[model samples]
Target: MNYKDPSLPTAARVDDLVARMTLREKAGLLFHTIWFAPPPGAETAESMIDGRHMNHFNVLGGGSPREMAEWHNALQERAAATRLGIPVTFSTDPRHSFSSNPGASMMAGAFSQWPEPPGLAAIGSAELVRKFADIARREYVAVGIRVALHPQIDLVTEPRWSRANGTFGQDAELTSRLVRAYILGFQGERLGPGGVACMTKHFPGGGPQKDGEDPHFAHGREQVYPGGRFEHHLKPFEAAFDAGTSQIMPYYGMPVGTEHEEVGFGFNKGVITGLLRERYSFDGIVCTDWGLITDAFIMGQEMPARAWGVEHLTPAERMLKAIEAGVDQFGGEACPDLLVELVEDGRISTARLDESVRRVLREKFTLGLFDAPFVDPDAAEEVVGRADFARAGFEAQTASLTLLKNGPLPLADGARVYVEGVDADVAAGYGKVVATPEEADVAVVRLAAPYEHRPGAFEAFFHSGSLAFPAAEIDRITRLQATVPTVVDVYLERPAVFPEIAEGAVAVVADYGASDRALLDVLFGRAEPQGRLPYELPRSMAAVEASPSDVPGGTADPLYPFGHGLTS
Candidate 1:
């Protein structure tokens, strides 16, 4: 139990301590929760509110810096109270930006709001990406977040996946290089002291999800590797491993009918152990995608537990299977008790527990948590949301703006321009803007497709797998185009192809997360359009419908192909 003994090498010391750990303590390391503090006066009351506890799965509702720090300290204290004093390594979803499932969104109030990964990639500077990671590391370290569950390196090949905002873009080569830089920035040269471990995710690239739906739901759980080009997905991950990523997370989808494993990657022995460990020689910890061990609840509605091709297995059975298959930890998992129960039942061997525990301990030791367990509370404000950070975000936003067209008319400086769709304040900085589309010489209509909200029925909205746009809004844009030489800017997160507007407008531009200044800069020819379309813009829902939900290949006729960008 003397983990601190210098006589033994670090790994061996970890192994020795791990060998002495009880199954419960080992399992505890595997499960992490997003720790948030209770509301102002809620702690003293006997009855608990819904969002009071440390949920472990999603955002901790919301918390102030002091509250967050206090909660993290308490959680670490609890971990220290355990037999081995294995400090709980807390993790977070991207706390920096507004993208993908904001129910899990952490406020960027304290942290810098870097442009999402697409914009960062469009900036196309490896150094900037690294710098972004470094800044994030400082902020995360301040908040006691040991693991940054991000730098999602999935190629943005599939346009329909709701989570594509997190990816770099479609080019495998670009994504590969950036992933390495990003990993280096977040993890540093070594794990210990002032560095936050990066968990590079959705291994073998999660971009090719069938029909662009996330695998979190049962209907979207199948992944197709048609043409056997599945190896293409492995490139960035290979780069990540080479760059020394501390951890990897397998995505939710399974390669159902492919040459790869039949079960979900997390539980697939061939994928996690046979390929990742044995073939690739990856020694880092493998974490399961969020909620892989239990039944999923979408918007408070409990759906039937999906085993992802392993239909006969229960949640407990799947936990044992994943651990035996080679996953070292569970991302956002709720059931550590199940892992303990499996060990007690001899379903998972003590040797396997020791193997995983040693890996986890190695990471902690590499991070130098033993030497400096607490972060400086005073440094929190100084490190987060600095002026330079906003400037970087603005620069990235500028670079990401893609100009898709030019007409007989070019934007003249001091021209009366109108903007619609986005917030009025966000649009006003563009030019002599107006409240209505008809008031100006030119109209710039910005549009983003609606996302699913919780109050809406989950099965009808998400699980059934359909995308719809409001007809009224579509009509309004079409009507405005009749009066002026309008330019349409579609933030195509889910590829809402406005055919009516596409035909009516003089020009069209598609981008991810372009700010007001960037949008106007491109409009006024202050900046050239250098960004290429990361994914093929679908012509219609029918085009998407024609393609197999499983296989996403063999399409040349898109509204706009990948790499297509028209400069003004």
Candidate 2:
């Protein structure tokens, strides 16, 4: 009960809470389970928050800001009434973007819509990065989200990696700079009341996957370091440590041909304990990536447990290995019963249990959750996605447009224009709209670069596999260009092999994520394209295949090297 006292230090409060907890309550602290948004009028939040005795959650989908704030307060109320009265902390993947992968990040629903992390990297202003983080922190705190599972500092060394959208680009120094700003933005000078703690992720870096495959599936489980650049990947994390991030999350990919054990980082004692805990001296919480201990169905599709090299181990064995590897919590999984069983059976020592529970409780205390767990729902309605905040996000989206070619840019006003992949109504405002490329003075086309499509709705969201455009799509671009001057824009989530698009399009522009108006603003000279290439755009898929995964700019001759951009 003394833990509730505001005057006590966080350490003293953590000690009080840990000493009072039973083995079951301590076990529950080690799990941060997933919770999808239920339909309106559904009665599920209470069961998961109180009935299951879960205190940490990774929120998947959510409704309006006011609704989410109310729901969170309701959950906290239920938790407050429970014995020991631990407050629930909610975490979420990056949400202020166009991408809507429920597993990776959510869509920009009622929140200020900023371009993803790469867009921030493109803008290349530490001040802007910090401001974005602060705004995100304010919106998150208003709605009861206390932890951010983002600012993925992984270098975009392997251009084909599906998760590059969440990175600060391929340069270690640039990523490190942004990482410092991001941490400061979320956690502030110190983490306490009003601070939204940042969980800097994929420790030692998650990039450099073999053939750029993600570790979410069996095919993408291996992370190779052929260029002998293992230490190079840790630079941003070192910066993260300096910035005082609240937590670290290791990747799921198993290392191949490295000095570390050839298991997933979540279970690699040498990587987690030796590199992170000992060498880096990161004493904060270490949570495993989602779904390492058990299989779960997502979006009506069955997914195998992402245990990687340790698939042969049982669930209990997996938990033991993760603990021994120095993990404090498990993401996307809740197995307090299994943890209870392990301690009761004498397989895991209670001393080991105390170690993790202390770290978890310390965070709760530091967050001031024990003193003030609830938020004002009325204030949340006013704070979330205010007009000023949304304008800044829109401005950043416009600023991030990367101009590859400016062949007669700022096309003369009142010229006849034909457009595709852009709103025709918006295009009409700039010039007279034409039906075909032949009937226009200039043509505009927008396309997302191609990838070898994967099955399943969940799998499809991750645009992995090959980075090349198909022949037909490439030919179509060339034919349209022959008829008239064509301005083409490609949404570059991954580095696309587009030598043909580069040569054929009279004007080419690249964007991470932008609105129809934002893209047009850049084309018409209304907004400056302030982004540089985050990663190398390889000359061909052959060059990408030949390059080493771990090495940045490994291709012999990239069409566009890192930091390449043009001004109109």
Candidate 3:
């Protein structure tokens, strides 16, 4: 009855809910899984709201704000029909960024799109990062998304790491400052019921991956610290802790040669219980990175469980170990039956299950989900991706462009231009669009940070491996540059190597995630590239290989060092 009362304190409400929940219901609170959006025809029990009693979810795909809100209301209506009526907590990865890697961040659909975190880092303003978070939070809340699986504050110490675009940058102090601002913008001075809760991720930092290989794959499981700067990576999480971030998700990478066990951070008791819980005093809910307990087929590929050191254990055993390791919930896992089995067999105590359930219920109650569980579908359309938010995003895209090389000043007004990899119609707004570089006074080309091609549908999205531009690609760019004074804008998703292109191009600029209009505005001097290099651009793959994974600013004589920028 107290849980049903809106006037009661969150703790009291949580206590009431915990006392009444059955063992199966308590077990259900420990698993959070990928939520399937509504099918074209009839909907089924994919969410386990009735069959498994699971309530927490991570929404994968994008949708219009109105449709998302309507789906949420329908989903919450199902929860209301349940015995206990515990409202669902919908969470999502970064949807405001340009990165479309489904494994990392979702690309925007109807949501306002902005530059990636590194672009915010390029601008290097805590205030702007906070503003971005605030706008993103409002957009998320409007569509009934209560949890943010982001503000991924991992320090980008490893330049070749595929996940660099999701992080702030390599500098620990700078990242720490931004992390604090980001959490504040999302959760605010208090974890206000009106605000969205942040799940700051890849705890203790996920950036120092061995050989720059992502831990998402089996072959790339080691998180090495050859530079002996393991403590350096924890600075941002410490800042997150200080900022009162509501949740934590440990990374999937296993520690290679650290004092702790050589297991993934999600399954490491030393890291989670001893380090995060005891030393740092982080009492927030700790969820494991996705798919750590079970293996399944995803994106037409055989996805293996990221059990790391405990791959030898059965699924039930891995769940038990993670529970003992101080994890509150399993991310991207839905098998609450396994949890019930563990508790029924006396392998996991009821007290342990209740402990996690208490955290879960407290968050739901504190968020006011128990009091107001549904959203207005009509209100969502007007609030999300509104004009002001879109304008701010466009401005950020323009501001984040880092001028790495100085060439000719703003293109001669109405001068002829030849373009590649850009919208010709957008180019026509500023200058005469010519078909050939030979006929133009200047040429513009867009290049993406190069990656080794993988065949898998999902794996290919991850831009891992060597950060060098292929020789053939370089030759083509060189040939283009010789014909006219050319300007190159490379998408610096990961720090890319393109010395030949850099040498030949009249001007070189880097953008994390810029729109065509944003790039053109900067090209025409309508806006200044008010950004500096967030990470150093290596001169070649040789320098990238020579640098230690854990050390920041260690690339040997990088073509463009950190903080390198120019303005005409």
Candidate 4:
């Protein structure tokens, strides 16, 4: 077939292949579902690929590098045996970070660990962003993950929003400055064979949620823009589009009171078709956010699909609406049967299905998956989490630590230290690990950015709602500060309210994601804390609540403003 010829142009090959694909095969191309990290040679996925004709998968869990490579090889081998022999394209959320919010990113179990995106935002260096993307690209290719569901270009204007930690923070100009570098590093000047394709996400801005609530759940549906900075938020995404991002994932939030319809971005025709497709001229793959058509069972709890304004519609209607809204594929879903039904019943046209299929197949061809899909397990083992990469990651972790208040930092050696929320052995390298504050000369306490505990295990993965530390917890922390000259390091997953801790602690540090060693390196005189706050740390929840969700840095009295940091 002409489609099998590598010498042929991609468009010609895509056209030829689309003509030959069965309705089932064509329907399968419209759905990109989660693999949920099955065993290396799991027959379940193989059976589905052959039976349902599905090929796209999201790598949802972690394993050894060799094991992941072996799994990729096995999956490819199955594809080779199929009638058309289309290679499976594997995608993953950010896995090179310390924070393991399944909703946003996963843990770097064996992957080289770097700081979170907010940490990258704090550094605010385009070159550094490029370097990190390059390193991440190399690691991803080693394990056969061809697509990255990240470079989450969503602005961090809404400080209390759960997903801000994964995004470039708060400034349109800074994020725009960094996004071109990010895309260039990941996919080079152009996406081709051996390059990891970036899916820059939550299109047309997902920030500015009502009451700082994430739209992943039903209660958090409305995405308001009272500040009318809608055009301001599009700057980063416009940059991403220009840099040749391969795919786009619109967020679940429905734009309320805007020129666009009240439905979610995934279901809103005006936003997806009119804005992203027409205004921005982004012709890349437009996939919906996870579970837009069906419910999910994540971390052993039943979760509803984020249908937003279209919750009243059935799953099939929702699927049809998303397809009509200019979506090329359904993310985190597997029901191509409904699509097949839609087409057979004449609700969806063959031309429409082929249009999306062409886009999906073109990426597969451009990635050279059809020609060479297999990977070497040995190379995977050697390249992943290697010495230089690990060292670079550690350096980034150290570089991104923000010293909010430098009081009594750069502590002397052999000082008696009372440690809380840090490993004793790790802290011992810098000072004597004392059992109690009374026995110690100084105290080191590590705390996570406060988040409201919602019901269900899956819901808890998203640290949304109140940024304020609980009253009792604040009291306990104050009591600890009274014991000794306490050095407090709080992990700022998102912008938080911690004025009391800022005032009470002798020294206060903010880290996006760091190890005990990295913290100790900065706490001691070994490494300089060169990071700054990505967004303002508001003085109180009242300040957080009173401030506009769409606007950045207008709190009543911020405890620490953006770019606030100090050196020891």
Top lDDT prediction, candidate number: 3
Kindly report which residue stretches of model 4 are placed more than 4 angstroms away from their true locations once superposed.
40-43
Candidate 2 lDDT by residue in tens digits, 1-568: 7788889888888888888988888888889988766422325655555556679999889888888998888788878888889999999998888887877888888899998888888888899999999999999999999999987999988888999888888999999999899999999998888898888999879999999999998999999999999999999999999999999999999999999989999999999999999998988999999999998898888998899899999999999899999999999887778889999999889999899889888888888888899998898999899999999999999998899887889887778999999999998878899998878999889998678889998889888878889999889888888889999998888788989878988888889889988988888777888888888788888888888999988988898888889877
- TM for candidate 1 is 0.87
TM-scores for every candidate against the unseen true structure: 0.87, 0.98, 0.99, 0.98
lDDT of each: 0.68, 0.88, 0.89, 0.89
Give, for candidate 3, the lowest lDDT window spanning 10 residues.
Answer: 38-47
Clashes (N, CA, C under 3 Å) per candidate: 4, 0, 0, 0
Q: Could you give the candidate ranking by lDDT, starting with the highest? A: 3, 4, 2, 1
- What digit string (tens of lDDT, one per residue) describes model 3 on residues 100-136? 8878888887888899999999998999989998998
Q: Per-residue lDDT for 1-568 in model 1, tens only? A: 4576655668777867776766665676676543334523434211111212121222354455555666666655554554465555667778776454432235466567656777666657788789888878877787677787877887655556676677877677878888888888888877766787888888867777776666767767878754466778788888888889988888878886676777888888888888889999998889877667666565667755446877678888888788878998876565677877888998888887877777887888777665456655566555566678767666666676666666833477766677766565655555676756567888877877544442345543432233445578678777888988898887755445556767888988776766666777777777776666655666676776665432333344776666677666
Per-model C-alpha RMSD: 4.0, 1.3, 1.1, 1.2
Pick by TM-score: 1 or 4, better one: 4
Where does the lowest 10-residue lDDT sum fall in candidate 4? 38-47
Q: Which stretches of model 2 miss by more than 4 angstroms?
A: 39-47
